[model samples]
Target: MARGTLFSSIAGGGLLIGIVSWLAGTAPAAGVQQQSPGSNPPPLDYSLTADSQPQPGVPTGSLTKHVLAPGKFFPGTPHNYQVYVPAGYDRNRAIPYMIFLDGSGYAGNNVRVPVVLDNLIAKRDVPPMIAIFVDPGVMPALSDEAQNRYERIFEYDSLTPRFANFLIDELVPEVGKSYNLSKDANDHAVAGISTGGVGAFVAAWNRPDQFRRVITWVGSFGNFRGADRLPGLIRRTEPRPIRVFMQTGRQDLVNYAGSWYLENPRMAAALEFAGNDVRIELGEDGHSNRHGASMLPETLRWLWRDYPQPIAVREPQAGAGRGIFAELVPHRELLPPPSNPAREGGAGRGGQPATPPPAAGRGGGPRGAVYALIYRDKPWEQIGGVYKSVASPAVDKDGNVFFADLAENTIYKSDAARSVAVFRENTRGA
Candidate 1:
């Protein structure tokens, strides 16, 4: 029943999702979050960028739909998922992929995600990847008059890992049967809006081994289904290896559930407080995903920026919120390896059950894993002043950069205007 330009692919198959029950259901006049079906959705409209629109030279991708009926996780419910393979997607190679929790809206006309991905891929802003638009399961109607039950709220808004487990244990493996999907968590991303947005974060939070990048648009993060506990959980638990991009509108007001606008910031603060990589955009739109959709291209770019690099777990930061999250999480054992009660330390990956011998010992023979050079956000930046070899570098009080070129035996200064000129010549390699 869905219609669009469905291009053929080298095995690129992802489903398009529609509105979620949580998103589409406006609980009568008691909730002012949504408009009547006939009225305009957002209070104010957002402008889509050129990247979000199709261009003549840009190449589009192929999209295919699939269904997971009577899935083991949610028995008797039918879940339909879609995959979008970008132009020139290589089926032979295991390519990075992203998941859309609530499929229809994003995969369908509302977000037109495949179109945006095509444009960004053309510009090389984001790598050529596959997208999985997974719709929540719907129970079959028992009879002509019996209504089918929607599983959106139960699955998307829950604090537990059941939904994520379904994706990992069932949906992903099923989809992987068709395409060479990346198994690396760093190569995976998850996204959603509204309750789907909460679901996205919850997925990455519970299963960082499956997805490390997350984007949530106007996530319903309040008390509904214990999501209000996320900020506290993020602050208390060991920092997960995840990167997040979030957006919320000031007008995404409070309801009987909680404040959409407020919860997003709380989530962002907790992520930042834990020293995780996170970016958030606050706009003037409402609970709708229009503004977030407009920024989708940028969001993908940010989420997938510096790919192939491993996303590492970080120690909590050092500040006020940091003070709360700074303490190391409880491990099975507290003592050093070989001495702890568990006595099984210094044995496995990241040491043994109790944290193995090395703080100094673990066994990889130096070249320590933690000491290995890892790239986080903005790992290394080019500050414009480039020379063959720099022996000394200094910055002025006013922020001008000065460096000495060792081989050239000259010192150069890059002023605030970013102009590189010789400050002193013939320094004699000092």
Candidate 2:
């Protein structure tokens, strides 16, 4: 294994491809290809190159740097932990915090969390919070020929609380020595991408009392490191205090362990089944940082919404969402509404009360011209505000028509004479 930035530790050897294929169970897909008998193992191509460098010029407002206390986890070896303290952080008032696994990767390459956090906090898109980026610890090597840096797979892949404990019992208290931190789990979040993503979920699942928010990008939930059983476990285990955000690309790794697409969605289903507040986004790219970078800011906003609010596992009502958004635009409202008495009774031709048109407008009939309501997405100035469009229109017994704006989920009403009026706005539970 290499020892530079943790992102550089990706095993680029050919064995990794073979390992991935085997883990993803490519045999079935390959078996259909009809190969010769006794073809030991397929040729491995592990030269899959991807970006592993952190981007430059990230804004770090109020973020502080903290060096880990030597002799804590990897005794006698010191490591650096980067902390991003959001604006309005008060020593007298404890604030929420986030712990980033694979710190070197997230802090540098993907999402550029420091910059996003700074901008979001400044704009009040999310509450002020702190982020602690910690890298994996390495054990001392006995000799040049006999070295040990395998801690990544062990600490990251394990389902036990050892890793979580290392952070809460050791690293956290050490940081507390310098700053005030709320011990409430709801005030804390843990996040990462790839292997670290799975590790983030595991930490929160094992100890929700210490971490209630989780964000994972391209999480490896496959059989590697005994993580393949996570879905089944989540199905059986009681729900925990976790609001999760997951993202993966269709082109992500496809190996014996399975594509991040298949595994991440499966984990998402499990999380949702367990009543965890989870959001999963699928992309079209491969195992890369591009999508993650684009989604980071929004994902963080969703995760930290209502910080201390305990994540509840309420079964989604079968018809609640349907009724909530169904009948988006009323049928009659899709066309122009009928006119007043002039067009209502009969008569209407160049200022002269000529013969009436058809019963339902156009066609030709004795009854006045009955115009149909038509829906439109036109910009309009109403109620002292500007609106994009009108949707979910309804008509009253008196022939008054109304509509709601899908963009803002607002309702608008029009008189029987086709005059538009503002009704209710700020819908979708406001």
Candidate 3:
């Protein structure tokens, strides 16, 4: 039941380009960080000049509309998408390409991505690239008065590989049928705003072999169904060959999901800890496209700055801490054996089983008993059992002990009287 403009394709020559410019002299917003020198050049004025716009003699590209059938990825859901081929596109050459989510909004005049692409492609600031703007799917309502079931939240916010699979398996193949898209991951990029922004990152994260560059603006990296765990995943997983650009605003949404303002920085820190190539830009604006649209031209340039340069993976620094590296890495040290064998349950100097020393204030307790007294003031006793590889032991207030035998995937318990019994059955190899 979702309604919008119908599908249509327009040749580059038929699409009119007009000159529009925004002054870049305005001071940086309150929370905006100034770019460092030699870094991405300051955001240039995206206003189209006569040369930047399509002139009488200037070569222009084409915009084509496409519809993806329902049930192709999401059952009973359909989506509309647009593709923009730059002015210099050559059918024979394998060119760089990018996929943008929230297609209708971005493809419109508000974002004017095609116009930005046109200007940048003309100025040689960015390599000639194809842009695919894809809208999220919608499930139609059965009645006219009923509302349609929008799938944007489910499609964009879920932390699954299905969306990525849809792109890599269905959409990319569909696009490839019409154009010579590059097979090299270096030439592929994915981008989106807000929920779509998170989707963009997820797609590349799940399928780095298909896409290697990511741009996320005001991304919903908060707890929108497990997305907040991405930072931890990034830190724990081995580094992948992907470059990332992230942007967020101080005034972004802070609701039941979580604060976008905080999550973006956390993600950046995790990416940095993992030694991935990542750049983040922050501003005072809210969770809107004002900042993202204004900076899109520069973002595209930075994303593809060194064309064909293979994105490099860095070795995670030692002691990065709080990741798989920290948990699994071994720190070796040399130490002499215990000076007294008796303390380690070994034979004493006289070649007899050594009796452990008693507590300072307690007497008449069993030797080597971990506890000196039971709750009833009875002597502490050891359970009558010989166990193999006992692990993760716990004791109850009633003087009962519970432990697991990981090798057998079984749990055992001991009563106060030193009797042992199986507490549980197979534990699925845990």
Candidate 4:
């Protein structure tokens, strides 16, 4: 089989869309539960696409399962993980690989990762690679009176380098013991959904040197365990060589923390503001993985659209993003001088005229509204002395303007009197 066209890579060759016939109609799956959905969303009768199903002509891969005893990372806990080696994979040559959190979650049911990999590899749509399906660790109960300890939240929800150390220091090296794994960070990817979805980002966020690509489906980047602070973190930190593809539904989780629906978009905006390559898809379904699973085949295509070439951090463009991005606008003329080399031939042989920065108030929209507000009437004035990172300034009905110091996850309010004060602290990226 030959590789697909460039468009096919981005569009997944239109590989999705045949996953179901709606077996249950408007009724939801039995015992389905969520905080936002009063009645569980409808259950889906999914039929696999040719790519997601076993094909008579496609080459199949082998999946081997192993038990992992908890090590220094999380002592006394143990779990299981699986490894996949595509048919005809060479023992001497190293190959790319991916990490899938909530391992068994994606391996079967609607995803059927083994089958999907077989088809994608056979068609040469994605590079031949290995996949690690990782199940969360749990502390076994010692007696009938003792309750078992679940580590999923502490492992996946906390936004720290601990989980990253677990993967990069312990789990990955253990997997490498038996197989020839690629050492290039660009060749590695991490993925997860819901709580595990944020886990995937945390892996790469803390260690861009080990993984450069991130895939999340309805990622729970909310206040569950300080994950909502991710967007602000991205806005202030230097950009990492990472590419991200996230899927969020209109009807996602919402609780005492905040709305995942709002957080995901805000997260995307943060990545954009930080000059990172990011893509997002918004659907109409609930928080369930129905939509994310249906688009799995296509999501992979977009994640690795251009192969071999490394994913790199992009330079922030003036007026290109929301929140802190407005600070990048230029105060001088938008066009280069007529005698400048850029205007002559250095920029291009055709000498195309440079596009001016987005119009001040009209161009940046809400992003620049704060900039306009700051420089309006006269010149920009320093309101406060200390601010690590500022993002999302909005005016209330009473003419009170509020903005966030993303690094601290604190929101500040500037009242009509022009005095700025702390409105809320520990917003968790709200």
Instruction: Give the TM-scores of the predictions, in the order they appear.
Output: 0.66, 0.60, 0.63, 0.69
Candidate 3 backbone overlaps, count = 3
lDDT of 2 at 369: 22
lDDT by residue (tens digit), candidate 2, 291-403 = 66665776777877765566666542222211101111134322322223232111101131122222332311211122212213444434423567655655554455667
Off by over 4 Å in 3: 1-58, 318-430
Rank by TM-score (best first) = 4, 1, 3, 2
On a 0 to 1 TM-score scale, where does candidate 2 land against the true structure?
A: 0.60
Per-model root-mean-square deviation over C-alphas: 20.1, 19.8, 18.6, 14.5
Prediction 4 global C-alpha lDDT: 0.70
Please provide, for model 3 over 255-305, each residue's C-alpha lDDT reduced to its tens digit, 9 standing for 90 to 100: 666667667767766776666777766565555566777777777777888
lDDT of 3 at 55: 48
Q: Which regions of candidate 4 fall more than 4 Å away from where they truly are? A: 1-35, 39-48, 321-430
Number of backbone clashes in candidate 2: 25
What's the TM for model 4?
A: 0.69
Worst 10 residues of 1 by lDDT: 1-10
Model 4 weakest lDDT span, ten residues long = 18-27
